[model samples]
Target: MPALCWNQRRRDFYAITTDVSTEGIRFRSSSRLSPGEDLTCSIRHIGLLEARIDRAVGEEFTVSVRGGRSALTDLARQFVALSRAQDLRPEVVRVHHRIVPKQKIVQVTLDGGLGVSGHVLNISASGVALLVEQSLEIGATIQVGRKLARVMRHFTHGVGAAFLEPFEPSAVHEAMTL
Candidate 1:
């Protein structure tokens, strides 16, 4: 499985998992990892997994699972699900609005004026997918630029938010450009 690795204080980097077991996982990363370093590992569709470096040999490293055996079990399950999903044809679903790809850096303000930075993955008249470092609880309301939105789903990169009201294309374009 493809994985992401990043130190607590640094940005995430792409990695590939060589093996995984109930105890831990072995992966290769371009980023140098020191033993005992704290890092977060994220695999597509598996969500985030907390781990600590246990050993490093060249670019290959072994990380001890911090989420315990249950985390590994969940990871295994996700791997199986992903493999099964590959055999199915992609499904087409209609939505209230057309989604367009738009990558833009924007500031999000949560309740209490707490602010976080996120990258807009895509935007539609009624919703958006944002890539952020912070994890927000589902159903939390946040202000994306001047628009109010509610968190709908959590992804490996960040959260999906549905806006309180539909946005005009010009308004979305104008806001995202900032």
Candidate 2:
């Protein structure tokens, strides 16, 4: 499954889980990480977890999960359930999972510098769903907080905009402004 990890510097990188167990998780990441490094990872179907790198061999690394055994067992169970669900109905899974933002109200700026206030319904690495009064045309370029995006679709309450460039999965969290 897709995974996101944040290094000690708070920079985020994308990763894919190759193996998981109550003891640790092994993943392949494009970003080079050193052994003994610390990371905070968010895995699909599993929430945030703290880990320490045990070994790094090129793109593959193993990290010992840092938490109680019971918690790890629970997370392993959830992973099993998610794997079964995916095998049963892969089409039902979303390409990019949406997460609710802690700070929903955001300032949106149009091409001409027109500013509008909007509320974030949900956000993902690729795009955001928002509730705004302004009727924006499809393909309209706009800035949501610090990121530039283009309107992709319209809904009853608002519009869906895809980011010009995808954000690091860990960057779209509660502490972020948008």
Candidate 3:
């Protein structure tokens, strides 16, 4: 196992579990990030700091920072550490379903013709994530229950998708309630 250094002070852990890659990640007073703004982040692992902006989705952005190690490295280290720690002690929590949700599982072939299987990690009125058996190209097109999903980006265990046809919000909500 490798060692990772992170801060114990900052509470911004959203970047940790998320698979979204940003050219830059910044902490600002506002609740949003603009496309062109430089992002500065304080990472909790490996005492690394990074400065970057979105150069391109699913690609490396321009990185320049004065202090700490590589932001990407620090983040990667934290991920490894967190994953190992979670494995040691297991915890599970369940929330009762108010409505029985409807879901469909499917396997998709990459645009390059590589076949992979991913479970529907989640689905809502908006979209779903196919927790694929293998990684696919970032811009790959996927077939989901006759619908198409253009790969926006890859998450830790799967890829994210913006549904070509959004599901009905009420139906999703009702399904969750069941």
Candidate 4:
């Protein structure tokens, strides 16, 4: 009955449906919900409409929408028309060690014969995975991309690089491309 949008932040989709009696549309997901969790949305018909998940009612999320009634109506109409035309089948790729994306591979050349080649695996808001030929002991300093990070923990074939400074995405992406 109303338009639905995807919450990119919370990784969910939502819409305002008159089909149901609730003031906001229902978002269905299995993820644990806490109050004030962020949400984002994309409109198939109206392009992308992002918003925050305002509330959680059981397994359904209620979105806090922006824009006026006319805009909402237009977006809803487009969503309905386009939503029925698409078929989406999603697949998941799981790994034993959490993989970080958009990373680069480089050869770490220490002062001694500790030089080794490895790749940057999982990257995060705080750290990165310096996958290497050897899993260095914790607190060991290893070169990742360009900077040296201490080995926070030993993973399967790598060590989590805990930077004294944060790992910048741009630098990591550049290193990975090389």
The C-alpha lDDT values of all candidates are: 0.81, 0.88, 0.50, 0.56
Instruction: List candidate 3 stretches off by more than 4 Å.
Output: 1-104, 112-115, 173-178
TM-score (C-alpha) between model 4 and the true structure: 0.36
- Alpha-carbon TM-score of each model against the true structure: 0.45, 0.47, 0.37, 0.36
Q: What would the per-residue lDDT of candidate 4 be over residues 1-178, giving only the tens digit for each residue?
A: 3344434454443444433122544556556565565555553335554445577776666665556455557666665666576655566332232335554666765435577887766665356766677647787766655666677777678777666676454554433432
Q: Going through the candidates in order, what is the number of backbone clashes in each?
A: 0, 0, 14, 10
Runs in model 2 deviating more than 4 A are 1-93
Compare candidates 2 and 4 on TM-score and give the better one: 2
Q: After superposition, how far is residue 11 of candidate 2 from its true place, in Å?
A: 70
Candidate scoring better on TM-score of 1 and 2: 2
Best-to-worst order by TM-score is 2, 1, 3, 4
Cα error, residue 34 of model 2, in Å, equals 67
Model 1 spans with C-alpha error above 4 angstroms? 88-178
Residue 167 Cα positional deviation in candidate 2, in Å, after optimal superposition: 0.6
Each candidate: RMSD to true structure?
17.7, 18.1, 16.0, 17.3
Highest lDDT scorer: 2
In the range 114-161, model 3's lDDT, one tens digit per residue, is 555557766655556667767677776776655567787777878877
